[model samples]
Target chain A: MENLLGIAIGAILINNIVLTKFLGLCPFFGVSTRLKNATTMGLAVTFVMTASSILTWLVYEYLLVPLHIQYMRIVVFILVIASFVQLTEMFIKASSPTLHRSLGIYLPLITTNCAILGVTLMNTVVEGYSLIAATVNGVATGVGFILALVLMAGLRERLELADPPQAFQGLPLAFISAALLALAFQGFSGMIL
Target chain B: MKFQEFTKGIIKNNAVFALALGLCPTLAITTSVENALGMSLAFAFVLISSNLIISALKRFIPQEVRIPCFIVIIASLVTAIDLFIHGYSPTLYEHLGIFLPLIVVNCIILGRAEAFASKHSVSDTFLDAAGVSVGFALAIISVSAIRELLGSGTIVIFGHEVVPAFTSSPAVVMLLPPGAFLTIGILLALLKRAKVI
Candidate 1:
């Protein structure tokens, strides 16, 4: 239990997906313009990430290890993610028209978001997480992504009105802000249980 | 028809500077000159081979299945390159680590396939791939050069320390993840000011 708490806290604060790992940057810049869309996109990614982590964990431990085809994990994980995104898109379109409309644009992009793949890959590659640990990391990473994105969106919403030079108007300003935010997150790196 | 398609990717639509795609690898692995070179060479090989194969077979592949097809081709090439790097240059392979295999999903490769390769002729597609790969390599090298020099107080390339250590205390912040953002952020502003980007 203590180990799990450490993993969760470490993932959420220390190894944040967007701020630290630099994954899912496309949406970090694109969909972060509005709070509504930011929340919707965050929730969408959270669902898919958690679900895919569970499924991929099963495949990795049962199928890949037993088959001795670990090199194929990349190909396998991507296919699973792509298909899962497709299925989720379909389900959203069929089930919740309102939520679907809000999240429609981000759904397809999530296929290439890299954060999803990064989480799954991190499970197998970096952390070497077990099945439960992978699920926890996946969900926690999703939370971390949400935390970063929401904070960015909130700040960007205010930054639009701030006075800035012409050259540093748009994406450049965002990068600077992200740099500061990343630096702030560094303070959490030393946290210990 | 040929040169235009190829040349466009180099300057007008340079993947990193203009398109803003593939920022992850562009920022992450570019902490050192050696990592930058290794990554660029790996990406160049994969981008060229994948684009060529995709263009050659674009006619047979259905539009709906194009993405999966492109991904499979890219993943296979990345795996092959990953294995080759591991066998030949264990040091470079170790330094690159996950980013090496993560190249499979680097949007630049797939973006080129979707945007140019699927529509252009085989020769044209090859040129586009080469141009974009070169452009990406240039961007990574330049960023890594700045970061490595300031962050570490020395310049090292391909496992050889080329420059003497400059300062006892470098700005260690420039070596961390935040430093990547700061470096690129400032570079982008400077480039825009000079109208280079």
Candidate 2:
């Protein structure tokens, strides 16, 4: 239990998917234009990350290890992620049309988001966590992705009004803001140990 | 073969600075110039090889299944490089870590395969891939130079000290995640101000 909590906290704050680890940055800047969009993207990512981590973990332990084709993991994990993303998109479309409309656009994007794939590889290949531990880390990393997105979204909403230089208007400024946010997140490293 | 096909990716369609296509590795593996070069080599191999194969086989791959087809091609290439790096330079492989395998999902590679290589001829696709790979290399290396110099007050490229210790106490944050963000952010702004990007 203590180990699980440590994994959760470490993934969420210490090694945050976006702020520190630098995973899922495309969506961090892309979908962070609004709070609502950010929340929807975050939730969508959480669903996929948690599901795919478990799926990939099971595959790695049972399939890859048994076959002794550990090097095939890179190819296998990505294929699994891409297909799972497609599956989630179809499922959402069938289950709820409105939710699908909003979240569907982001689903395809998530396949390349890196956070989902990063967490899966971390679970099975890097960290070798158990199935439950993998699930916790996946969800916690998604929460971290969400936290960074929400924080950046709130900052961006206000940043548009406080105009800086012309060259620093768009993504350059966003990058700068992210640098500050990352610096703030650096504080969390001490909190853990 | 028009030279513009190659030049455009270097400037107009730069994967990192102008388009911001692959920020994950642009930030993650760029702590040292050596790692930046190693990543560029691996990235260039995958991008170049994948573009050639995808372009050559574009007609054979059905439109409905092109994306999956491209994923498989790219993933296999990445796996090959993963093994190559692991055997050739264990230190670089260690430093690169997950980012090495993570290249299979990099948006730039897949994005180019789907958008450019799928439509253009094989030769043109090769040039386009080369140009973009150079652009990515330039961006990542520049970020690494700034970080290594500022954070450590020294720059070493493959055991040769390019920039010696310039400061008694360097700002260590430049080696951290914030440093990657700040370096690229300011570099982009400066390029914009200079009308470069």
DockQ of each candidate, alpha-carbon based: 0.72, 0.89
Question: By DockQ thresholds, what CAPRI class is model 1?
Answer: medium
For candidate 2, what is the DockQ-based docking class? Answer: high
Q: Relative to the true structure, how large is the alpha-carbon lDDT of every model?
A: 0.87, 0.92
Q: Per-prediction fnat values?
A: 0.52, 0.86
Compared with the true structure, the alpha-carbon lDDT of candidate 2 equals 0.92
What interface RMSD does every candidate have?
1.0, 0.7
The runs of at least 3 residues in candidate 1 whose Cα sits more than 4 Å from the true structure, single-residue gaps closed, are: none
Q: What is candidate 2's CA lDDT for residue A76?
A: 91
In the predicted model 1, the residue pairs found to clash are none
